[model samples]
Target: MIHVLVTQAGHLEETSKQCCKMSETTSKHTSALCTMQSLHLVLLVVLTIFVYYVSKPHVTEVQPMNRFDVTNVSYTVSMAQPTDSIQRTAVSERTYVMVMSQKRSGSSFMGELFNQNPTVFFMFEPLRSLTSLAMKKTSFSFETAVHNTLNSIFKCELTHVPVSGWVVKKTEVSTCFNAFEMQNNSVLRQICSKYDLTGNQMFLNISSTLCKRRSHFAFKTIRITDLAHLKPFFVNDEFNIKVIHLVRDPRAVMNSRHLLHEENLDFIRRKGTHADEVKDLCQNMKVNIAYGQHIPDWLVGRYKLVRYEDLAEKPFQVTSDIYNYLGWILPQEVNTWILRNTDHDDDKAYSRTRDSRKTAQAWRKTMPFPDVLNIQNKCQDVMKLLGYVQFESRQSMRDAKSSCIPFNGYLNHI
Candidate 1:
């Protein structure tokens, strides 16, 4: 009976051992399945994140305002209701003036007439960067590019200007205070300080704030050959565009260009002989004057044809006339500047530093008699139309200076 009892006890111990082994195997399988499920969940989460990022829309670095189409359509900016304090501060009304001219036509000097005004924010030769930008986008015409750039500037949409080493170089940003006439401007300085413009940022990028308070936004350009290229802007109700078609006597223009080794003279010389060049210049002057004369009746009041000579010879009178035409009261600061700049001593050389009136007739004494006669012959009819009297002899040249009458035909028509 004792032997049987001991055997049964051993059998019970074996059963117990088998149960323990089975339990261990079950735990091992459960752990392995949990690990596999965990790994699959982690992989699914990673794939979801990856897919989200990959499927997202790409944001282009270039602004849409930089792109221009050739269609004769007007662009209108819809005024958004100001939701922010910053946007609400923008001026409700602004005037845009384009001082258009050919090279060596005293456009820069004329541009400064507007620039000296504290209310005016002037940009010089903004189109000089268009060539570089145009090379990248061959689909758009050069005129279209210019139009787009001007639109951006006029609307104070700086980001719209091509900022990738095309418009506003890094060096220009550093020296902008002087270049943009912001040295003495407290408001602009304060804005610059607030933004902490480090010259590394694009000029157009900062101009938004700089131009915020300005009533007049003026820019000078020599790239526009035809006034018709700007017709779209004129039709756009958003833009109150006043165009100053600054002209100079073709003889003086030619002489100044020749003396300064300007590109206009170089281009002409490359194309033809001296006489042919003068004749071409005469033809261009006539065409430009005709364009000015035949400006659309709607634009007659908006367009003003001002002779550089007239502006130089009679600074105050001419400036007053321009201001009156634009319906702007000439600021005291601008008047002071005009007086200071125009009252300097006469310098014979091609320079901005000279008596304004003397500078008007400097080309007469310097230009050779044969060249003078050639220019006179080519330009005679237009010159007469413009009220510029030709000299009969070298002695009469000096006498003709005091007697030279200013053109009032446009004034009468206007």
Candidate 2:
């Protein structure tokens, strides 16, 4: 009986030891599971953070604002010439304006609206010199030249601008030298600094001096085909840039081009009154207008799209609004200029002054019916977008003297 009792006690002790081993195994498994769950939770959090950052829109570095009393500041103008006007002002913030458009889009006329302002230093087709340079395959790439030249010009570094870009009258300088040639030959760079307008240093010095004194700078260009090309300037706060994207009706633009015997265009590889020409023109317009509509953060207040038709219909009203946008009053001189220019009709090919309202409607009366339809068919989407009315019949288009363009608030809002 005693041996049997001892054997029972030993069995019970072995069973307790086995039970402890099972408990320990279960505890280890529970610890591993908890560790894996914690790791998965940490990974999930990291992945979410990565996605959030990746999806956010990129923001450029913003310029520091100059805090000053607005009540004390005022914009003043000193008219230099009918062509050249310089503004002298107590305002610290310099305004840089660009009138961007395609050729024969009445850009020259539209530019006059800003150019007439005494408080503004304006250049006409500065990039036209660059276009001249592009034909020669100069040292600077087209993009580089455009960016550098504009950067220098806006900052009043006139010497850095291509000498060809400057408007020194042929009669003004007795000893003539080709600045474009000097630029291409690198003769100016070797003689002076890299960006010396060495052909006539005096004119360069004078223009630069006058430019530096101005509170505002404006330039018009038909060279820039894409709004995306100006992204660098838009992103840079130093520029304080305002873009006036001037767009005209494709049919009118084509008619003007054809009338001038402009068989070749800078943007088109081969140009004629064809599907390719109108298609390319409208496509360029569409891209520019689209960019203006869906403007990015950097371009928020800096960009505006101006329609030629609207400006022609009411030059004074539109010009006044433009001046107001620039935080300046429309001077009496600008109004006078507008009055003189818009009221009179001129036969000259490149005349800035014209019966502006009549000029806008000339296409309807002169352009061949088939040609108008061709443009309308090619640019149907752009026409719809810009609120241009397409004529269903030749008689309707030619006979109607009143404005065909409806007031599209979406396109021409101040």
Candidate 3:
């Protein structure tokens, strides 16, 4: 079974990183006090040929009402029983999903989780589509011609490549980075093995399902949450598309980020405009629910908002939820399998001892108080609206604010 979890977080990441960059120059006192870090993460995200839109502000989390036709939602949520006469959805056919987000956070983690399913396959981020688009816009280059065909297929661009025996999928590169994820992504090989697929062959893994029909495949380019406006690319009814949205507390997100250096904005293009930070974050949560608010929502109270803390503390359970969402009963062997597959148990095992827990408070200890306030204040409205009280109680704030990133203040020597 090919299970899918779509996490859309393009600009949310770009914004925070840019915050680090601008904060360095914007604040006079913190410039030297705060050792300016390098810009690897930000650069990695920007230079990515996949090109999602974080340059814009006030990123609109797509509400169901924004686009989904009720009938289309029905198609997405429709389930086919193994014995049902309603015709089994074609196999050997492929579906696609784009793992999107600003840099950091857990988008990559989810992608890895989904990839683990034996039934799915992927191209981490071939930059196939973006390269293709650029090639067409300019003149086709040898480097991009192969992918330019891929980009054309995906963008449904001006050029039309004949659909032979394959599909072109366009998704974010973070999804392809195997550093945190693993899966039996052999459908590509299987398809190529089973069929004499041609260069013109194309289909899309819009639902992230493996091509049971196995054929040579490639995902062109997908819309990043920053480039969220492009979501309509998959919003129609003809092809069944499933979307997953992942959100973590902004606090802990900030903690993991402090370990990283700030990136440069020259690489990022400011496309969208901003209105309110907190409101946008809150609405993003709502948008996640609105699109896939099936019976038990995925975030809170039906919605499954995987707390990064919980995910790290209890990876199996978190993944079980993910597996379940993808409509699969996780194999009982998952625990032993994970142990054998990777060194993830260490990241998951809960740290014992008060000292260990205190060490986890790196964000609070290292981030200057004002930076914390800036992060909280920026997202404070969402905090309240989502039933997460503002940053009043430090202990609860630390515990609850484990989803997103926070601001970094002056550094205390480790």
Candidate 4:
């Protein structure tokens, strides 16, 4: 009986040991499963965070504010974000003005109107350098170059100029001086020296000075003909852009081209024959003028079509109206300059320096009757659209009974 009891006790001890081993094995398995689950959960969280970051909208560098008072103004610009390809945020408030016109269409004269304003930082034919740069960088489109350059100028972000994607030549900064005729301007000279851009430094670092002052920025471009091409600029909230679409009578434009060609026969020869040149010019004028006919709803207030004739015929009134349209208070200095410039009588053959008032009617006298007829015939539709009266015959002028209905479609604002 004692031997049987001892054997039973040994069996019980063996069972207990087996139970302990099983429990240790189960705990190890459970711990391994828990660790794997925790690892998976951590991985899932990391992936979620990465996806959220990747899906977020892209935000471009914020445009710097004007140095002047912008306490009351707020600008919101939408740009596609790089990461998620979504547009977010608003552009800052900086006024940008562009004079859109064709060559020899009184763009220079209109540009001068803005140039005379002390508050305006005017850049004339800024596209010339851009075009040159675009040619070198074949990968970059001309439109893109223009867009970037204009934005940089308006934002006073000079360092953004000669951007690798748009500009191939870093030394193109000298072009600005040539465009603005700043070589003799003392202020520009001082600024250049301040930036250490004098002498061998052809590239400009304009940020040190130009960006420090706040002013309304303006530029004139004859390079762009289609209004649609400027859509990017118009929609960009970074700039409160106003467009002045200047148009001249086709007859006047033709005559001016003819006269200019006559003066520079070599240039005319290089371009083409007189007829071909005039035909091309007239076609370009027609296409560009027609762009104004159907102004987009978004552009109604932002775009203004101004006839060179109207501006010349009624300088003060038209200018005042322009100022009002642009939401600018015509400064006393501007008024004084206008008065002083327009008061005099101009009698020059072909001088951009003459009193602009005389320039309005000079086209009528300068263009021969037959040539005027040709131009009128070529541009009849546009001429009529722009309120230019065409007499069927010279006799109709003497009769004073010719049908007279001025088509002032875009001029309703004036």
Give the candidate number with the greatest lDDT: 2
Candidate 2: which stretches are off by over 4 Å?
1-92, 138-140, 168-199, 263-265, 268-275, 409-414
Q: Compared to the true structure, candidate 2 yields what TM-score?
A: 0.69
Question: For model 4, how big is the CA root-mean-square deviation?
Answer: 18.9
User: C-alpha displacement of 80 in model 2, angstroms?
Assistant: 17
Clash pairs (backbone) in predicted model 2 = 87-119, 344-355
Across 168-271, the per-residue lDDT of candidate 3 in tens digits comes to 34332322322221232333433333333223212132222222221212231222333234344444333333344455555545555555555312112112
Give residue 234's lDDT in candidate 4 (0 to 100): 72
Model 1 poorest 10 in a row by lDDT: 65-74
**Candidate 2 clash figure, as a count:** 2
lDDT of 2 at 22: 62
Of candidate 4, the 10-residue stretch with the lowest lDDT total is 78-87
lDDT of 1 at 230: 79
Judged by lDDT relative to the true structure, which candidate is superior, 1 or 4? 1
Ranking by TM-score: 2, 1, 4, 3
Tens-place lDDT per residue, model 1, 182-220, is 432333444444444445343344455445446667888
| Per-model CA lDDT versus the true structure | 0.64, 0.68, 0.38, 0.58
Measured against the true structure, the TM-scores of the candidates, in listed sequence, are 0.67, 0.69, 0.44, 0.62
Q: In model 4, state the lDDT of residue 260.
A: 61
- Over 1-414, each residue of candidate 4 has an lDDT whose tens digit, in order, gives 434544554565565555555656688766565555555555655665676677679987644334333332212111111122111122243467898877677887677677677666666666656554554565868777777777666655555555332222244444333323443122343444444443222332333123324356677877775677777777766567888888887766767767765443322323434546555555665665554566676566787788887776677888898888888888776676677766565544433344665565566544567876776777777766677788676555334334332334437733
Q: Could you tell me the TM-score of candidate 3?
A: 0.44
